[model samples]
Target: MTDGVEPGTVRPGGRTARVREAVLRAAEDALTEQGFTGLDLADVARRAQVGKTTVYRRWGTVTGLVADLLQDMAEQSAPRTETGSLLGDLTANARLVQRTLTDPRQGALFKALIAAATGDVKTAAALHRFYDIRVREWAPCVRQAVERGEVPEGTDPHDVIRAVSAPLYYHLLISGGRLDEPTADRAAEAAAMAARAGVFVRVGGKQA
Candidate 1:
């Protein structure tokens, strides 16, 4: 989904754009400090120094605002790294996720969003879309690996990309373990090895 307001409601570098930027940053601050359950449109408007009516007109509900926030984040996410080899590329991807989840603010923000998604359908769908975009961005690296004959034919690029970050999320949200460089490296290495072993290969339109 598109970020912020609907089409033609905001123009680039216009007042509406500025308002969107302020509101989204405020939303981030709220999510970081208070979690999803604490998010309030009036509070966001106060934080953003914008009119409550404006926020309401643009985003409608707390869930709608959050959906837009996720879209904005996806759009602002960094481009995938190209490291010439699948292991190197996957390592870069893993390290990126590690750093984000290890950061004080980002980690809390993601944890809040994830917790929100567990019970909220809109939040869950937004979160899924956010990851889908990110996965697509990195999937090309795996496809390139296939082209280079580094992985078996029919290797699923999306699966390989997801594998690199799965353990990192598990550490962040489940195990509460340290997300150090070694952990990221191990995740990347395992995914690379598994890909080479045909563990991610597709058979009959399904993962084998």
Candidate 2:
């Protein structure tokens, strides 16, 4: 967001990186406690103990700040687990999602972000990018499954990975159902079944 110091140009653990960490943590706390509409750069600056001018110059706008927050979330997401089987790996993935969406702070932050994305195209793009990064993080699990002959070789890894978490999100954002670990396992089991049966493979007879 700053001029001259391009995005991703800051050295790791540098001053700019430290400022981003503080600001983003403050932003996360605000979003968790008061949702997206309550997000303000001044408040974030006060909370982060950084200068208002610095926050202003770094992020420019609330929308830009939210976008940066999403980018940080994408980078901070955990890598995929390596279980011995497809179902094991997917279940682990599903449970990670379940734990996140059920946790009070994490759930509230995501809800605020998702709600903001509904009306803002830029926010929606940022949200999509966040999901893409998260999905890519776990895509390797599907590739391993293919090598182990658990799923079809031509399976679309991203499709299978998304399917595992789709229902859990439905419960969180749409269905208002439970977010229990069992529900997570069921979602994972169903996705793994579909994937093994080639239901998640490309429709065009192509591999992804």
Candidate 3:
């Protein structure tokens, strides 16, 4: 079925956005309370106080719902702030990443999502899309820095952005290291150092 806006809900510049926000929030809450395997559209509809038909009509399946939810989150998440310097931008970005990684609810939700993605191709694709959006959102800071001569001429902004969060994600998903503010700062500094040394610079038009 072709799912569009909910019936009786306005679109573009009005309550439609708010209704979508509420639905997404309910979906996140459902995901937090119950992992991917336990996620239920009925529960989400009940929590959101929206129509079940609307939920199902809008998202054909659980994977589609989760994918839409992740996309909405990426859109709502804060964008990179320009502080006129690479250090400032990287620090701010690192702090944001750390805060999200350390948040109990979000962290647990992510762990569950990772587990689900491990077994489900659809979920894995959705997860990849989420990271892609996040990476694209923050990559511009590194590009701006390059233009300002703060980094090498050939720095890969996307790689630089990904590098900033790689260590933090590794700690959370692998090493079990603490993701504290200090660690966040260290990651930013490390990424900065690497960029300065041309490590982030692309070679042979290929990203490493």
Top TM-score hit: 1
The TM-score that candidate 3 achieves is 0.88
Collision pairs in model 3: none
lDDT of candidate 3 at residue 158, scale 0 to 100: 84
Candidate 3 least-lDDT 10 residues: 4-13
Clashes (backbone N, CA, C under 3 Å), per candidate, total 0, 0, 0
- Candidate 3, residue 182: Cα displacement in angstroms equals 0.5
Error of 3 at 202 (Å): 1.4
Ranking by lDDT: 1, 2, 3
Which residues of candidate 1, in runs, are more than 4 Å off? Answer: 1-13
Query: Residue by residue across 1-208, what tens digits does model 2's lDDT show?
Result: 4467433323346667888899999999999998888989999999999999988877778887888888888888878899889999999999999999999989999999999999888789889989999999999999999999998878999999999999999999999998999999999999999999888777566643
Ranking the candidates on TM-score from highest down gives 1, 2, 3
Task: Please provide, for model 1 over 81-110, each residue's C-alpha lDDT reduced to its tens digit, 9 standing for 90 to 100.
Answer: 999999999999999999999999889999
lDDT of each: 0.92, 0.88, 0.82
Cα error of candidate 3 at position 124, Å: 1.9
lDDT of 1: 0.92
